[model samples]
Target chain A: MDRQAWTTLFHRLLFTSAVWIVLSGTDAKALAVGAFAVPAATWLSLRLLPGRDRLVLWRFLRHFPSFVGGSLQGGVDVARRAISPGMPLLPGWVEVPVRLPDGGRVALGAELSLMPGTLAAGVRGDRLLVHLLDTDAGFENAIPREEAAIAAMILGTGKEVGP
Target chain B: MNDLATYAFTSIGLFFFVAGSVGFLRFPDVFSRLHALTKADNLGLGFIALGIAFQAESWRLVALLFLIWGLMLLAAGTMSQLIARDALRERDGR
Candidate 1:
């Protein structure tokens, strides 16, 4: 499905499920209700919540795989931190240059922090200060992957590097 | 025991959300606000999730709650990073 339909479907599902929880409908009924409710809500929201752009939603889904991949990588890092025998973790702040606008920078910073071993220490202009626990593990050094992931997520392509 | 445990979790979660909001209101800058939000808000949400998880009637609800919790966690962490970075950026410009 195209991005718009997918997003509309998601919106429907989220609301229907939310409603089902509060009301406590039976299993089959809840599923049917939600199935109907979500699409209805989507239609209503589309009609009512005017001027809402779906670009970010589209971009987000496009970048979703990488985000999940990054999150999994982060989980592994946490495992490493938990299990690593005795080596002292070298924590350092590294700068990540963002070529996108402030909004994109904001989006990237938020997305990256979901990964393990990294906390957004600071941001200056379009540059984000990322604190990494295991700088020597090659993850922090290979900043391009994170950047590329963010790029895919926010801008949706390499060509539209910045705006 | 279960009732008491449930209440305790729920209360703690409510307390956390309140404390985080208070901090957000009182804090001077974006950085401090992010600091307030990340730990407390998430922990609060965690507590809320735990409370809900306990009350969940079926595996489906439990699984759905967990998924929602996971998404919330992602949002909290990411948004905080964005806030922290922007605060630093503004700080640097001045």
Candidate 2:
């Protein structure tokens, strides 16, 4: 097998083994069943979601901290608004044209949805229909920033104009 | 010390949960409520998981807690999209 295939296989095995340990715990009797089940499940998963795009682990790792921080901010921001008497929400929809390709577009949509005050409602052509908790939130500026990061994470550079 | 930590985290989790509930009640519309629900649930459950992680006997439990949280995040994102889309479609219709 090629190096990429081997890497994928190794990661898959490690993930399945960890799952097996979690499910079976320290029980010795279940080890036998897990030995058969884990590989079968891994194979099935691989078949269903074949790793088409080579996920750049280093880039992903680099991007993860920001994503986590964004999500936490999202939670706290909503909670604050929820408890506030003003409940200042100027909710509206904005269609932003994205520069990323299909995969990057989907990732950006999901990632933005997890962030504060943004929900990727739909996508038509190159524009993503986003719902905002506050319309004046400067989502146009903020989204492109995130799109840059996501584009880097997926396409290895923000300059790549995705088809 | 651990007990104190647990209480702090748990309370914070519960606080977010309550906030989410309040948002659900007070938000003007469906899209806003979803915004509250998804974000609040992610942080609420995350804090709760951290609380439990402090008391966990093994790393496996911590990993499992996080795994469950990740699954919830995925569900929240997908559900929010679905609900928001439906709401938008209805709005456009009128």
Candidate 3:
């Protein structure tokens, strides 16, 4: 198969294997099983899903690192709030208009929610209902800072929200 | 060694949850409050889950717990997006 196809195959394998290990309830052999099973599943899925054979590994993997990074960033934000609960938390719900297709936008939204201290409260068409931690002082003050962070994590550089 | 590590992780996890809740209650807006819940709840749950995982005798049980968590994250995240999208649409129109 082509390069993208192979890449896609590998990813599907990892995801499938992860599911397997979890379901099997055998951590003792998990790493071992995961190592091989993941790849096996990837190959099998590639064969099953007929299409352009165009694998979006980077398309998805690009977000994987953000998962860890964003979570850590969020963790710090949480810690900050804990230390100073009354610290002028900027709280407000603003809609982030999305130009992304329905699926892409939906995917992005879900990922954002996974980030610390942000919630995808609602969605109507391309509009997103986002609630920031503190909005009292400023939409200028709070929303932009956090939204920007959220945008970067979700949309990558091209999707950064305009200031 | 593993037990100690698990305990430490649990402590940190609990700490984050409390912090998030404090922010949620104290914070001034819907957005901030949401963040407080999103951030803190996950950590709180993570710790509790980790403790159980470490203490449990069966990998299958732990795996089940993890599976549930993954699904919850998926569901919650999607719901968050839907709400955000709808809210934004209403404001721009009005």
List, in order, the clash count of every candidate structure. Answer: 6, 0, 33
Candidates in descending TM-score order: 2, 3, 1
Which is better, 1 or 3, measured by TM-score?
3
Instruction: Report DockQ per prediction, comma-separated.
Output: 0.15, 0.75, 0.45
Question: Could you tell which candidate, 2 or 3, scores higher by TM-score?
Answer: 2
lDDT of 3 by residue, A1-163 (tens): 7986666556676668768776765566767766777676766766766434333546445655657576666667766875673574545566776555444555556666656555666565667666655455332233343444445544454344653
Q: Write the per-residue lDDT of candidate 1 for residues A58-131, one digit (tens) a residue.
A: 76667667665665455444433333455335555677776755555655566556555566765656666776
lDDT tens digits, residue span A32-89, model 2? 8888988998898788656655556788888889888998889889989999998888
Candidate 2 per-residue C-alpha lDDT over B1-94 given as tens digits, one digit per residue, 9 for 90 to 100: 8888899998999999999999999998988898899889888999999998899989888888888888888788877887887888888893
Cα lDDT of candidate 2 equals 0.83
Docking category of candidate 1: incorrect
Model 3 misplaced stretches (Cα beyond 4 Å): A1-21, A25-59, A82-85, A93-95, A123-125, A134-163, B28-30, B47-66, B82-94
Distance from true location, Cα of B41 in model 2, Å = 0.9
Give lDDT: candidate 1, residue A83.
36
Candidate that beats the other on DockQ, 1 or 3, i.e. the better one: 3
For model 1, the superposed segments whose C-alpha errors exceed 4 Å read: A1-59, B1-63, B79-94
Quality of model 1 by C-alpha lDDT: 0.61
